[model samples]
Target: MIIGLYFWNLLRNQQSNKTAVDRESKKEMEKLRKLRSIQLTQPLAEKTRPQSMKDIIGQKEGLKALKAALCGPNPQHVLIYGPPGVGKTAAARVVLEQAKQHASSPFLQDAKFVEIDATTARFDERGIADPLIGSVHDPIYQGAGALGVAGVPQPKQGAVTKAHGGVLFIDEIGELHPVQMNKLLKVLEDRKVFLESSYYHEEDTNIPRYIHDIFQNGLPADFRLVGATTRTPDEIPPAIRSRCMEIYFKPLLPDEIAEIAQSAIAKLGMPESPEAVRVVVNYASNGREAVNMIQLAAGLAITEGRDRLRAEDIEWVVNSSQISPRPQKKVPKEQKIGYINGLAVHGPNIGTLLEIEVTSMSAEKPGAGKLTITGAVDEEEMGGGARTLRRKSMARSSVENVCTVLRQIGLNPFHYDIHLNFPGGVPIDGPSAGIAIACAITSSIRRVPVHPRLAMTGEVSIHGRVKPVGGVVAKVEAALQAGVEKVLIPRDNWQEMFAGLQGIEVIPVDTVEEVICHAFPEWAESISERGESEGNWIDPSIEPAVQPILPFMQARSTSE
Candidate 1:
C-alpha cells in the first residue's frame, strides 16, 4: 500500500510539472499577442509605395524599358540609373510581378525578392560573415552547438542564395566593395555561389549530409540582379555595365512632384490647399521628398488646429527642414547691358541657369587694368594616384580664353577694368560658360543689350568659335524651365533630338559672330548696314553702358 502511494505522488508531480510548463508557454504567447496588438499607423511614404507599374509616375520611357527588359521568359539583368525618389526601386519590384506572370517564365509563385543595401550591408572580410555573398561558418563559431565540438563548418545563405529562382536587388550598387562586387559577378556568371571554409571537408563522415552536398555543389543563385544607383552611367564600372541592360529615369519635374504630393495627401486623408501642394513641389526636389514634406506639414496643421494645410505651413516646414527650392532664374523684363544667361547642368541630369553679369570701368592706369571675378572658382585640386595637382579653375581658364577672343574680335580688353560676376552662386562645372562670358564682356564694351530671354551654352575658342559641350539636353531643359525663349548651342553639337522641343528655340551657332547677331540683333543690323567685317572693335561711335555717378553724389551732398 505504501509503494502504491509513492507511485501516486510521482504521477501527481509529473502532471503538476507539465501544467506549469503549459501555463508558462500560454503566458508567453499572451504577452506576444499583446505586443503585436500595439501598432501605429503606416507612414505616408510606406503607404504610398507603388504597388504596380501603373502607380509609378514621372518615368514613361523608363517604365517602358523596364518592361521590355524584365517581362520576358529570358529576363535580362538590369541597372537603373536615376536620382533618389524617382521610382527606380518601385519599378524594379513591380516589373518582377509582371515577369512572373508570363507563361514561359521559370519563376515560381513562391519565388522571393531579396534586397541588400550596399551602403549598409555588414560583412566580415575573413569569410566569417557576408550578407551579400554566402559565408561558411567555421566549427569554432558560437552558434555551431555540438557541430562546433565536432569541428564541422556551417554554410549560411546570403541574399544571392536566398534570391535563387527570383530577383536580387542591390540598392546603391556603386557603393559595393570591390571584392564583394567581384564575388557577385562570379555568381552571376556561374548561376551559383561556392562557399568555402578552412574547416570544411567534402568527405567527412562527421558532417551532415546537407553540409557534404553543399560542399560538393555550390548553392543555387540563378536569379536576375537589378541594381539601382544615383550615379551617372560613367561612374559605374564598365564590366557590370556590359552585363546589364541600362535604363535611365529622368528627374521628377514640378508637375510630377505635385501629383505625388496630392496622392500622399489623399492617402493620409488630410486636407491641403492648392497652394500648399504647389509649395511642396516648389521646395521638394522629388517624389519621396514631396511626401515627407506633406506629412510634416500635415502634422503641423493638426497641431495648430487648422482644418487644412496652408502654404505658410509648408514654408515653415521647408525652412525648419532647411529645404531649398530648385534654383530658378526668371527671364527679366528689362534688358540690361553686360547681363547674359548661361545654361549649366547639376549632377547627372538636372539643369540650372547661371546669370553672368559684367561691369567695366576705365583703368586707373592705362593698360594696367584689373579683371576681378566674383563667384567664379579660381583654383581646384585634381586627384589621382598618390598625388594632388593644383589646377586653375575651368572657369578661370574660360575667362582667359574670353580675353583672347576679345583680341581676336578687335576689342582691347586691357583698356577696361572688368568685374565679371556669376550672380546667385550658380554652379558651373566646366568651360561651358565661355560663350556667356564672351557675350557679357562684349555687351559691356559695346553697350549692346542682350536679349532678356536668351540662354546659351558652349565653349568659346580664342578664334571666336563656339565648341560643343556636354549635357545639352539637361541644359536645354533648364532653359525651358526658366521660360527662356531662345537657346544657343554649338552647331556641331546640334542633333535631331532637340528638334521637337517646344516652348524654346534652340539655335546652333558656329562662331561668336552668329552669337552676336542673334543676341544683339538690333546692333548687328546697324553694323551690317554700315558693311563692316563681323569682327571689329566696338564702333568708337557707340557709348559704353556706364553712366556717371555724379548726379547721385551731388544729391547726397545736398541732402547732407
Candidate 2:
C-alpha cells in the first residue's frame, strides 16, 4: 500500500508540471497576439500629394469643374479629354487636395478615395473581383482559420469594402472591357454586395465547426466614382458613356500659359526671363508642348551652369526642338518682253481675243526710248498667231530695227523710257505684244505725246502677224480703269463685242498693219489719208482720230 501511494503521488506531480508548461505557452501566445495587433495599427506608406491648387497647371477648366463638384450638392462624373501632357491626370489629383482643404462637411470625412488605373486593374480578373467583391477563403485568412479553435468559416474583405463610403477614381477608364464595365454598373446600381456562403458543415464538428454566414454581409457601397481618360466617351461602351459626364479639355490660353510658366519657375528653382518665357511659349507647337520644352530647357540650363535663360539659349533649344518656318523666295525681275493682257483681240471668225498691253519702253522720262532685250523665246507658247515672227537675240537689235523702220517713214520716235506690265502676273511668252510695245516706245522716244485716252491691245507675231486675241471685254475694262477712252481690239473680236461694250470705242483691226497705221496717223499719213480718201469706209459714226503731238516742234525738244 505504501509503494502504491508513492507511485500515485509521482504521477500527480508529473501531471501538474505538464499543466504549468501549457499555461506558460498560452501566456506567450497571448503576448504575441497583442504585439501583432499593435504592429498592424501603423499607417500605410505615404504618397506624394500636390502642394497647392495653383501649383497644379495646364488644366484650369478641369480644376474649375472639380471645385464646383465639391462645392455643389451634386457631384458630376468628370471626363477630361485632350492629347497627352495636357494634364488630364494631374487635375483630378488636385481636385482631391482642394476638396480636402476647402470643401465644407467635406466628402473626405466619409468618402473614401480609391484610385485604380483602368488600363491595368479593370482587365485583371483576379484584381477585379478581388477588389470589388470580397474573396472567398483567401489564403491570407487561412492562418486565422487554423488559429480559431472553433473552426469558424469566414469571408475575406476586398478593397471595394475598404473604399466603402468613398470615391473611386479610375484613370484611363475608356480601356475597361465590356464585362468589367458591366460589373461596375452593377455595383453602382445595387449600392451593396450580398455574399452568400456556408462557412462549414455541421459534420466537421457536432458543435458546428463553421458559421453558416461568413462574409461581411449587407455592407453599403456609398462610394462615388470619378474616372479620367484621354479617349472620347464615344469610344467607350455606350452604357458606360450614358452613365458618366464628359467635359472636353481645351488648350490653355497665353495668360494661363504664363501662369504655368511662372509656377514651374518658382517650383523648380530655375531662373527665367520674360522674353525667354515668351520665346518658349510662342516657339512651342502647343501649350503643353511648350511647357514640356520649357521644363527641359530649364533643367538643361541648371546642368549647364547658367542662371538666367538667355535669348540665345531659348532660340537654340527652339531651333533644335521645333520646326522653322519656310523662307519666302524672291521674285525674278520683270523683263521688257511681249505680254498679253485679257484685252488683246484676235480676228473675228478665229474667236481669239486677248487684251494685250504693249510696253513700248520703260517710262523713265515719261517717253518711249530704245530698248535692250535678251532671253530665249518659248516657241510652243506662240500658237498659230504668226509662225514667221523671228525671235530676236538682243533688245538692242530689235530696238534698232524698229527705229530704222520708223526713220524710213520720217517719224522720229525717240528719247523715252518704256515699260510693259501685264494685268495678271502671267509671263508674256509670245511676240504678240512686240509691235504694241514698239509703238508705245516710239511715241515716248519721239517726245511726241500719244493720246492719253487711247489704249492698244494687239499681239505682234515674230513675223508681224498681228494675231487676234481673246477676252477683249476684260482688257477694255482694264483700259477703262486706267482712264482710256478708245480700245483697239482685233477686228475679228468687234462683232463679238456684247451690247454692254458702249463705254469704250472698240476699234477693230484685221492685221498688225492696221494697228500701226491707226496708232501713228502722223507717221503713216498715206494710210490715214486713204481712210479719209475712202469717205464711206471711214465711218462718220467713228470718233475723229486724235492728233495730239508734243507742243514743241523741234525734233529734239529743249527739255530733251
Candidate 3:
C-alpha cells in the first residue's frame, strides 16, 4: 500500500510539472502570435496610408526632377538641397510616395523599401555594413566543407539585398563620412550583397561559391538611390555629389506660404480666415515654421474654445513664438535732419558719392540760370547728417554766399538745377557731405560741368569746415567700383588707406576752404592777386569747430 501510494504521488508530481511547462509554453506562443499579428498588420496599414502626388506642395523644381528620375527611361540618383525644414526631406517623402505607386504592379508589387539615416548609421561599422550585406558567417554557412552542412552555399540576404528591387532613402546624406559615402555609393551601384570571409579561410573549393558571392557583381543595377541633404552641392564631397542629380529648392512665395498655412489649419481641423492665414504665414517666413506656428495657434484656439481664428490670435502666436524681426523705432522728423550727398567729395569712412542731375537753371546774369539740385548721397550717422544738411541749407539759403564765392572765382554757370540719388538707397548721414553735396548741387545749379571723374567723401560743419568721415576703405572701394576716377578723402585717413588700393587717385583734403578753393581756382587766384593781406581775407569756405547748428539730414536711415 505504501509503495503504491509513493508511485501515485510521484506520478502526480510529474503531471504538475508537465502542466506548468505546457502553460508557460502556451503563454509564450500566444505572446509570439500577438507580436506576429502586430508585425503583419503594421505593414498592411502603412501601405494603405494615404499618399498622393497631387496633394504634395512646395519644391516645384525638385518635383520636376523627381518625376523625371522615377518616370524616365534611365532614373538618376537624386540629391535635394535646401535650407532647414524647407522641404528637402519632404520632397524625398513625396518621391517615395510616387515610387510606392509605381511599385504596386503585379510584377513589382513585392518590391521592398529601406530608409536609413546616415548620421546614425555612421557610428557602427558592423551595424551599417551588416544591414546592407548579410554577415559572411550566417547560420547557413557554418560547418560546410564545400558548402554548409546542407551541401549548398546560400547567399546571405542583407537589407540592401532585401531592398534590391526597390528604393533606399538616405536622409542627411552629407552627414555620412567619406568611408560611409563610398560604401553607400558602392551599394547604390550594385544592388546585391558582396560577401567575403575575413575571419576564416575556405576549407572547400566546390561549395558552389560562398554566401558572400552574391554581392560579387556589386549592387543590383536597378535598385534606386534617393538621398536628401540640406547642404548645397558645393558643400557635399565631390565623390558623393558626382553620383547624384542635384536640385535646388527655392524659398516659397508669399502666396504659396499662405496656401501652406491654410493646409495646416485644414489638417488641424481649425477654422481660420485668409487674413489670419496671411498674418501667420508672413510671420513664419517658411512652410515648416508656418505649420509649427499654426499648430500652436490651432491648439490655443481650440483650448480657448474660439470658433474662428482672430488676427489677435495670430498676433499672440507670432508674438509668443518670437518669429518676427525686432521692432525698430520710427525716427522722429522733428529730430530728423537732411541727408548730405557725399558724391561730390570723398569722405574718410562715413560717406559716399552723390550723383546730381540738374533740371532747371536761371541766373541774375544773362548766361546764369536758376539752379536746383538732385542726386544720391551716402552717409554714416544722423549726427553727421544734421551738420551736413545745415551747412548745405546755409549755403543754399544765401544765394549770395554761393554766387559771390563762385563768381569771384569765375566758376560760374547759367541758371541750374541739381537732382541727387544714392544707388543703394543708403541714407547719407554726416556733416562731411554738406560741402560735397553743396559742391555737386552748386555745379549743377551753376550749369558748370563738375568733373565727373572727381568723387569726394567728407563731413562739412556749419561754417563749412571739412571734417573726417569713417569707413574710408569701403567708401573708396565703392567709388572705384562706380568708375570714379579720383577719390578725395580727408587728410586724416591717408595713413589708413591700404597700399593695394587701386584704380583711382586718392586725393586728401585738409579743410572745406581748400576744396572750395580748388573747385573755384579762378576765385582763389583773383583773391590772391589782390594786395589784401592773408589777415584781411576771411576764407568763405572755412569750417568752424564750435558751430552749434546741426544739419537737417538723416542719410543713414534705412527707410526713405
Candidate 4:
C-alpha cells in the first residue's frame, strides 16, 4: 500500500509538471501576442504610405502607365524610371493592389507581391544564398533533417517562386548584380527557375520526391516583374530593358511638394498655415522629403505646445537641420547692360537661370582680341558599369560659335575685346547658350538693355541658325520660376515643347536674326513702328550707344 501511494504521488507530480509547461507556453504566447499588437512609432513618411493611387502625388502619367501595363489580361513586365522619392516604389505597390481588382487582370485573389531591393538583396557567388533567384541547401546546412533524404540536397525557393503568378518588384533594379540579372532574365524567359545541387543523386531513393521533381521540372516562376529605378533608361541593360515596357516619372514640382506637405500635416492631425507649408515646400524636393519635413515640424510644434503648426517651428527645423532652401532666383526687374537670363539645367531635371554677362571694351590695339571663358568645366564626364553622365559646356566652343554668328550678323568681335562671365561661380556647362550670349555682348557693345522678362536656351550655329537643344521643358520651368514671361527655344524643338504651359510664352526661333528681333524688343518695336521689312536687324534704339560702335559696325560690314 505504501508503494502504491508513492506511485500515485509520482504520477501527480508529472501531471503538475506538464500543466506548468503548458501554462508557461501559454504565457509566452500571450506575451508575444501583446507585443505584436503594440504598435511602434512610425515615421511620418511610413505612416503616410499611399494605400491608394490617389494618395500618390505628382506621378499621374507614371501611375497610369503602370496600371495599363499590369491591369490588362496580358500583363507585361515593366521598368519604372525616375528620380528618387518621386513615388516609384509607392506606385509599384499601389498598382499591384489595384490590378488585382481589375476583372481582366491575371493576378488571383491570393496573388502575392514580393519586393526586394537590389541594393540590399544578399547575393552569394557559390549558390549558397540567393534571395533573388532560387538557391539549394546541401545536406550539410540542413543537418540531415528530411526523412529518407537526411543527407540529401533540398531546393529552396527564392523571391521569384514566392512571387509566382503575381508581381516581383525590385527597387533600384539597375543595381542588380550581373550574374543574378542574367539568371533573372533566363527565368523571365522560361517562366521557371531551375535549381542544381552537386550532392544530389537523381537515382537515389533517399531523395525526396519533391526534390527530384524540382530538379526534373524547375519551380514555376511565371510571375510579372515590376522594377523601379532612379536611373535613366540608358543606364539599364538592353537585355533587361528589351523584356520590359518602360515608364518615366518626372521630378516633383514645388506646388506638388506643398500639396504633399499639407496632406501629411492633415494626416498627422495638425493644422498647417500656408507659410509653414511653403517653408516645407521650399525645403522638400520630393513627396517623401516633404512628409519628412512636415513630420519634424509638427513634432517641434507639439513640443512648443502650439496647437497649429507655425512657420517658426519649420524655420527652427530647417535651421536645426542646416538644410539649405531652394535657390530663389527671382527675376530682376531692372534692365541692365551686359547681362541676360540664360536657362541651364542642373542635376537630373532641376533647371536654373544662368546670368551670362559680357563687358566689351575696345582692345588696346585692333586684331589683338581674345575671348576669356570662366566657371565652366571641360564639358566632360566619366562612364563605367554601362552608365553615362553627359556634361557639355559651350563655355568656349559655343562662345566661339557665337562669335562666328556675331560676325555673320554684322557684329565686329575683333574690334572690341569681350569679357564674358557666367556669374555665381556655379559650374555652367551645356551644349549651347542661346543667342542670349551674343545679345548680352551686343547689349554691352551697344549699351542697350535686353528685355527683363526673357530667358533663352538653344545652341547657335556658326552660320547664325538657332539649332535645337535638349531639356527645353526643364528650361521653360526654370524660366517660369524666375518670373520670366517669355522663353526662346530652338524652332526645331516646337514639336517637343511642353503643352498646357500657362503664364509663359515659348518662342521658337529659327535664326539668330529672329532671336535678335524678339529679344531686342526695343529694336523690334523700332522696326515695327517704322513698318520696314527684314532689312537691318541692328538696334536703332541704343541712344548715344550707336555712335561708339556704329563706325566699327559700318567698317566691318562694308569690309565683309
Give a tens-digit lDDT track for model 3, residues 1-560.
99999999999999999999999999999999998777332322132222555544555656887777755546567776655555655556566556555543221556555777767753335432344445444334435444455444444455555556666677787787776666666766654445554432355454445333443554343567777776656567787778877765654545666887787676655665787886875566566777777666766787998867777788888788677732111112221112322442222112234533333344456655544432232222224433733234332333334344443333444433323433333333334454555565555444444455566766654344456766666566556645666667777777654445677788787655566555545644644555323212225544434422121111122232
| Full-model lDDT for every candidate | 0.84, 0.52, 0.55, 0.81
Ranking by TM-score: 1, 4, 3, 2
Ten-residue region with minimum lDDT total, candidate 4:
551-560
After superposition, candidate 1 runs with Cα above 4 Å error: 1-28, 72-74, 102-111, 232-235, 270-272, 303-307, 319-322, 364-367, 530-560
Q: Name the weakest run of 10 consecutive residues (lDDT summed) in model 2.
A: 41-50
- Per-model TM against the reference: 0.85, 0.42, 0.48, 0.82
Highest TM-score scorer: 1
Displacement of the residue 560 alpha carbon in candidate 1, Å: 55
What's model 1's lDDT at 134? 82
Q: What lDDT is obtained when candidate 3 is compared to the true structure?
A: 0.55
Q: Model 4: clashing residue pairs? A: none
